[model samples]
Target: MPLGKGELTTTATSLHILELIVDHGWVTLRGLVEETGLAKSTVHKHLSTLRANDYIVKEGERYTLGLYFLTVGKRAVEFRESYQLVEQKVRELGSRTDAEVDFTVEENGRLILMFEAAGATNESTFGTGTEFFLHNTAAGKAILATYADSKRDEILDTQGLPATTNKTIQSREALHAELEQVRENGYALNDGECVEGYRTVSSVIKRPNGSALGAISAGGPAYRIDQSRLKNELADHVRSATAEVTESLVEAQSTL
Candidate 1:
């Protein structure tokens, strides 16, 4: 949730410190103070509290995130209703296509990678828990294509179409036009939009009611996944995988 007026500033400070630690890998008390511009005593107190709670580990003067975060992250992934099915399909798609496969869902108007399966090449840098904008990736576009215009516009308004690469769609009108094609094609393509020299193909997974649940994507280096292969082969592979996952999700929901 967005921070509201009169919310606990202390909690926000603690989370901000944690995020800094995550971004930098490890940090010292002085580093946190410098980064946050908070008083040294305040930073020390938050660090001490987090260390006591096992949320961070201290090595000499440096602190890193603790294994407790891993435990919590595991529970969060398993808590998703479609995680199991998505996991299975991600693995299968990776093996079948020899490209990195990812299953992503929208949270707070951003795409979050929920599950990922490394391809044989192991060249992909993305992993589970990676968060990115919805206008720069094939998976995000696939999900956006499935959303109602009002819902899609809301997310776009909240998270403006920032350009990641020169090829990224930066205008709402242009994105809407591509999304229309994505709807008709049953898949979305990312041709060096998010990361230059990389390409991706994705298809949306839908719930029983036909609302988008998430998206499944396969991506690789542009040379390996050239335009022809991206449109025909990889697109088919991603669409097939998403179709299977959507079918299984619908069946499971019906039983429940």
Candidate 2:
């Protein structure tokens, strides 16, 4: 039997529906039809297929992701294994410095906050599941700065340089030059770029093969960070903590 182009397109649409469910958490059948611009019948058919595969589930009129995604996400993180280690190190860093430490992973063209911990002295208006602008945060720059020129340019082009604060980098040329400095220093620093009073310093978390896995950052108010006065002290602390986390990751990888 010959398979028609329409059938092939239908299969692709089904996969896209499942992906949308996973990405958006929950969506109504009507919303899926509107978002996908597919026929209502087509959307229903795809949703049924996804449900049959356990990739999605429906509760009354609403559909959400199912446990299959949990299994998939767990396996993916388990394969990498550094996610938990980095989380532990961030907590340790926060406790030792008495400041807020956050870890973020780059997924699907965005920085996803994976873990966070705050010490007694820590104060930053960020928490888990907070996604930040890739151009305006130290953690984001740390991950992006490690990317190849073309790859970085593509992201910048898509996201552009939306200013979060007056200090935010606006020009592509200026950001390009700043990323060059980050590459040279093996870390990135954002002094009130994301928020008026908040500052952060971060380094890329890399695999043994030098691929960027995520970033670890320490953030607090400008009154305390004072980069010019405390540059060496802060950098030394962050560098040591990052190194420790990297080493732990290496050890864990061996056991895998």
- Alpha carbon lDDT at 203, candidate 2: 83
Candidate 2 accuracy as TM-score:
0.78
RMSD in Å for model 1: 2.3
Off by over 4 Å in 1: 1-3, 118-123
Minimum summed lDDT over a 10-residue window in model 2 is located at 228-237
**Residue 115 in model 1: lDDT:** 82
TM-score for each model: 0.90, 0.78
lDDT of each: 0.88, 0.80
Write one digit per residue (lDDT tens) for candidate 2, span 5-42.
Answer: 66776677777777787688889999988897878998
User: What TM-score would candidate 1 get against the native?
Assistant: 0.90
Q: Over the stretch 140-256, how does candidate 1's per-residue lDDT look in tens digits?
A: 998898888999999988899888899989899899999999999999999899999998899999888998889988878877778898899888898888888788888998898
Off by over 4 Å in 2: 1-8, 18-25, 67-71, 120-124, 127-129, 221-232, 247-256
Name the top TM-score candidate.
1
